[model samples]
Structure formats: C-alpha cells, structure tokens
Target: MCTYITEPVDLEGSAKGARGWQRIERAHVSFDHPQHAPLDHALEIDLIDGSGARVAVELSAASARALIGAMERSLERGEAETGEGAA
Candidate 1:
C-alpha cells in the first residue's frame, strides 16, 4: 500500500549527487514504497537543489529512526559546544 504521505522542507546545505556536490535547496520526505530498497516500504528522502540536481536515500524504518536519533544527539552536542540554542 502506498501511503502518499510526504512533507516538503526548505533546506540550506549541500548534498553530493552523481555530478558532485550541489547546494541543496529543499527536501521531500516520505514514507512509501522505495525504488530500490529491499523492503516493502521505506523512509524516502530526496534532496534537491536549484539546478535540479538531487541526492536520494531510502532507509528502513529502524534505520531512519536511528539516523534521526543520531542527528539529534549530534546537534545537541554541537549546540552545547557552540553555546547556541536549538533552532
């Protein structure tokens, strides 16, 4: 079953695609059937840039959750070191 659940977020970063590093402008996050992942459904993340360059990722639900946790932890440590508040 396709969930058709997607969320678009504006981003300011760079992603390495086939062509090389591109300035990422936005990201589309969805939970649906993956194009290549070996699972019935996976978390899909498509990072896109202004010039239409893109970096795509598909992760299992458990992997996605772990990634999220790692990101949060890294951000927390970074913020503490920089004396910055969470954004």
Candidate 2:
C-alpha cells in the first residue's frame, strides 16, 4: 500500500538585480485575475522542504501571472460547486 499527503508550500523570492525576494504570509490555490508586473516578468520561487533544504523554482513573469489567474478561477469554481451543492 502506498499513501501520500502533501500540502502546498508558501514560497517567495526577489529578482537577482534591482530585485529581491518578496516575503509572503500565505498562499492558496485559487484562480483570480493575474496582474502582470514589470521586470521581464522573471521570477524565482524558493521554498524550504521538510528536511530544511532550500529549493528554488524559476518561473516566467507571464507564467506567474497565468498561475495567479488560475488560482482565482479555482476559487470561482469552488464557490460555484459549493453553492450548487448547498442549494
């Protein structure tokens, strides 16, 4: 038998030049409108694993914007699903 439990991690980081890691308090999976920020939209997401190791992920600014939009949409879907279920 195999089982797994995973929780999304809250990651944050700044740009390499004229940029730095942005501290985030929380993170949720919801599809909201994504805002495009400047800077070639280059972004790096860093998170620490259970073993206390730092991990970095490179994401394009465009991709990051898309993700935010997706998250917002997820929230929308969740609301719709729950609303219908309640009714």
Candidate 3:
C-alpha cells in the first residue's frame, strides 16, 4: 500500500549520479510504490539539486534500517576521527 506521503527536507550533501558527484540541496523521503525495485512497496529517497539534477534510491524496510545503521556508524567514526566529543 502506498503511503502517499512525501516529506521534503533540506539537504547539504553530495550524491554520485550518472554525471559523477553533484551537490544535493533537497531530498524527498517517502514510503511508496517503487518505480524500479522488486518490492511492492519501498522506502524511497530522492536526492535532488536545484539545477534539476537528481538521484533516486528505493529500499525495503529491512534494507533501509541496515543502511541507516551503517550511516550512523560511519558518522560516528568520522566524529571520532575529528575528536568531536572529546574533552
């Protein structure tokens, strides 16, 4: 079932697209019927630039959770390297 809900967020990051890495200024996260994934429904993330450049990803709930965990770990590692929370 499609959630029919999309939440747009301001993003300050870069995503690799067909034209290589590009700055992404916005993102839309939603649970919807996927356009390409094998699943009937997916957690979809669309990264978009102001100049009309875009990249899309669709993941199952389990995969999305795994990815989120991986991202959290990566962020923590980065912060550790930079001594973000050290006294």
Candidate 4:
C-alpha cells in the first residue's frame, strides 16, 4: 500500500548528486513506491538545491531510522570537535 504522504521542508546541507556536491535548500520526504529499491515500498527522500541540483535516496523504514541516528551522531561529533556546541 502506497502512503502518498509527502512532507517537504527547507533545509541547509550539502548533497552529492550526479554533477557533484551541491548545497541543499529543500528536502522532500515520502513513503511510497520506489523506483529502484528492491522492495514493495520504501521511504524516499529527495534533496534539492536552489540551483536545481537534486539527490535522491530510497531506503527501508528500518534503514532510514538507522541513517537518521547515524547522521545525528556524526554531526554531534563534528560539532564537539570544533567546539561549536559550546556555550
């Protein structure tokens, strides 16, 4: 069953697409039929830049949760190393 729910939001980050790495300005998250993922349905995320650059990722629900947690840890470590999280 397709969820057909798309949640889009503005974001700041960098994603590597076909051309190269580009700044991400917006992101669209949805759980629906995937084009390439080897599953009936997957959580799809589309990262888009203001300049029209785009990057897409499709992962299983469990994989998506793991990715989110890993990303949070990675960012926290980077901020800690740079003392950016210090008051």
Candidate 5:
C-alpha cells in the first residue's frame, strides 16, 4: 500500500487506526524490515522504475525529517547495490 511520491503523510492516522494496522500482512509500511518481511510483520516493497522492471528500495519514516532522510539513505544504499552488482 505504499506509493512513491514526495513525502510521507502526517502518519497520525496510523496511531488512531493502529488497532487495525497493528496486525501484519495487512498494514502499510515505510519499508520492509529484512527479517520481518518474510514473517509478514511488515510489507515487502519492490520498486518499479517506470521502465517496466522491478528493483528494491530500502527506507523508513517515523517523522517528516526521517522520511526525507530515508530517501537519501536509500539512494546511497541503492547506488552501492547497483555498483556492486555491476562489478
């Protein structure tokens, strides 16, 4: 249920609706925790590059700043992954 856009929402809704979202395999997530992804405690996301292929993106967002920060972090991680694969 994740969408690639500018930034994360206020995310306050999750708090009020936390009861429902608390259960895994049904709630939205900022990123998939490697360990939890397989367990369904979090949603696993595979990025779509608009070119018709799938890729992985890693990030997390607990706040406004962290959302943006995750993007930077994800960029670094993504680049490193791409570099390693290329080599």
Candidate 6:
C-alpha cells in the first residue's frame, strides 16, 4: 500500500544530475513505491533546482536508516570541527 507520506524541505546546495551540476534549492522526501529500486516500497528523495531540474534517489528502509545515521554523524563532526552549529 502507498503511504503517500511526503515532506518538502528548502535547501541550498548543489546536486549533480545527468546534465551535470546544478544548484539545488529544495527537496521532496517521500515514502512510497519506488520507480527503480527492487523493493515494494522505499524512501524516496528528490533534490530539485530552481529551473526544475532534479536528482532522485530511492533506498530501502534499512538503507535509509543507515544513511540518516551516517549523515547525522558526519554533520555533527563537521560542526564540532568548525566550532559552529547547523545553519
């Protein structure tokens, strides 16, 4: 079943798509059926640029959790080293 759960986040970064690097301004995160991953449902993340260009990712539940943990750790370490909190 499709949960149809989604969250939109404003972002300021760059994502490399098929056409090369683009300045991403936002992201849409969702949990639903994946278009490519070999799973019934997956965590989907779409990073989008102002011009509508986007880069997409789909990860299984376990992988998603691991990725989140890794991201958190990395961010924390980065902030500690920089002596600054998240912006």
- What TM-scores do the predictions have? 0.92, 0.40, 0.86, 0.83, 0.24, 0.94
Question: How far is 34's C-alpha from truth in model 2 (Å)?
Answer: 21
**Residue pairs in candidate 5 whose N, alpha carbon or C atoms collide under 3 angstroms:** none
| lDDT winner between candidates 4 and 6 | 6
lDDT by residue (tens digit), candidate 6, 1-87: 889899999999999989899999999999999999999999999999998878999999999999999999999999999998977
Q: Lowest summed lDDT over 10 consecutive residues: which window, candidate 6?
A: 78-87
Highest-scoring model, lDDT? 6
Ranking by TM-score: 6, 1, 3, 4, 2, 5
Query: Considering TM-score, which of the candidate structures 2 and 5 is the better prediction for this target?
Result: 2
* lDDT by residue (tens digit), candidate 4, 8-71: 9999879988888899999999999999999898999999999766799999999999999999
User: Across residues 1-87, which tens digit of lDDT does each residue of candidate 2 receive?
Assistant: 112222355644322322334334332332222234333334544354333343344456578789879988887899888874323
Off by over 4 Å in 3: 84-87
**Best-matching candidate per TM-score:** 6
Q: What lDDT would each prediction earn against the true structure?
A: 0.94, 0.47, 0.91, 0.91, 0.38, 0.95
Q: How well is each residue in 17-79 modelled by candidate 3, as lDDT tens digits?
A: 898898999999899999999999999999998797789999998999999999999888988
lDDT of 4 at 51: 75
C-alpha RMSD of each candidate structure in angstroms: 1.2, 15.3, 2.8, 2.3, 14.6, 0.9
lDDT of 1 by residue, 1-87 (tens): 989999999999999989889999999999999999999999999999997667999999999999999999999999999999856
TM-score of predicted structure 6: 0.94
Clashes within 3 Å, all models in order: 0, 14, 0, 0, 0, 0
